[model samples]
Target: MNSHPLFSLVAGLLSTLLMVSCAGSKSYPPLATVPEVNVQRYAGHWYEQFRLPNSFQKDGASAEAQYTLLPDQSLRVVNTETRADGRQKTATGRATAVSGSSNARLRVKFEGLASLAPAAEEGNYWILQLAPDYSAALVGTPDRNYLWLLSRQANLPDSTRQKYADEARRLGFNTTRLLYRPR
Candidate 1:
């Protein structure tokens, strides 16, 4: 009755579970105290300028995310990316607003199979900031490890970039770690 195989199996299972838990716990700090965001105006296409490296986005990739309101109180999320090799990847997901707010914060899950789960961990997304005119946005995690700068248009205005950076800094984000990707 050798115990080595059983011990190895248990260890592997624990490792896998730990990895999944870590991936699921990704979170960002609430947006720096700011005026309430007009979600209707904020809904639309946004081009990604910079983002913290995630398994979903490639370096030097050009990406866009479209948000649309749903009749059932959910958001239609469509994310498309053009990779460096000219390959396109698209992911569709549903985002539901977290309860008790104006629906500014949401959790988005790309895996459609888990769509029915009451609260799935895979689609944990939050909107960190938005420009008054809906021209730009800053998204990130509570731990400040992940951040994304997005613009309504393909190109972001210099003034808007500076303003977003300043706001990010005030929020205790490490602006230096931001990777400004070229579209």
Candidate 2:
């Protein structure tokens, strides 16, 4: 079957990402998240400073996430990104904090084909590092495959960027693979 070039590229990247994550799992020690996260302070707009490459976010720039605390305590997540085609894509999702995790872990589900599968309901969002004033955060998965460095602003200073990279490296993620978006 002859698939479109873009589709093939996306499929290949997705496959490679999953295979690498599984193959690299044994090399890292158990992933550890912060002891607690005050969702109240953590809520609001967060700019994506950098992230480990993933198929779902290909050709996207200026990615950002907005987390709103719902009355029911579940969070309404809105993610916006400018695409390579000069279009903006915004996805809204729901996130529920894992019980007994002190809000450090979240199960995020967006409205898409993936949500139809039961396995996609599992928790994937882990808060690894958060600044005292909630100015910055390092979030990743337990497998150390997916990682994102988030900030309250789009441009992080050189020193702060290094600090975030150092933290991700220390947490077992391969910092060299980080992909930064357009400023």
Off by over 4 Å in 1: 1-35, 112-123
Which 10 consecutive residues of model 2 have the lowest summed lDDT?
114-123
Specify the poorest-scoring 10-residue window by lDDT in model 1.
115-124
lDDT of 1 by residue, 1-183 (tens): 454776667767865885677576534444543345556776789888777677667877888999887778687889999888989988888777666545555667666654443332322455667667778778765556567888888987667777777777787677876666573
For model 2 the TM-score comes to 0.82
TM-score of candidate 1 relative to the true fold: 0.72
Q: What is the lDDT of residue 136 in candidate 1?
A: 78
TM-scores, each model vs. reference? 0.72, 0.82
**Per-model lDDT:** 0.70, 0.83
Candidate 1 achieves a global lDDT of 0.70
What CA RMSD would you report for each candidate? 7.6, 7.0
In model 2, how large is the Cα lDDT of residue 166? Answer: 94
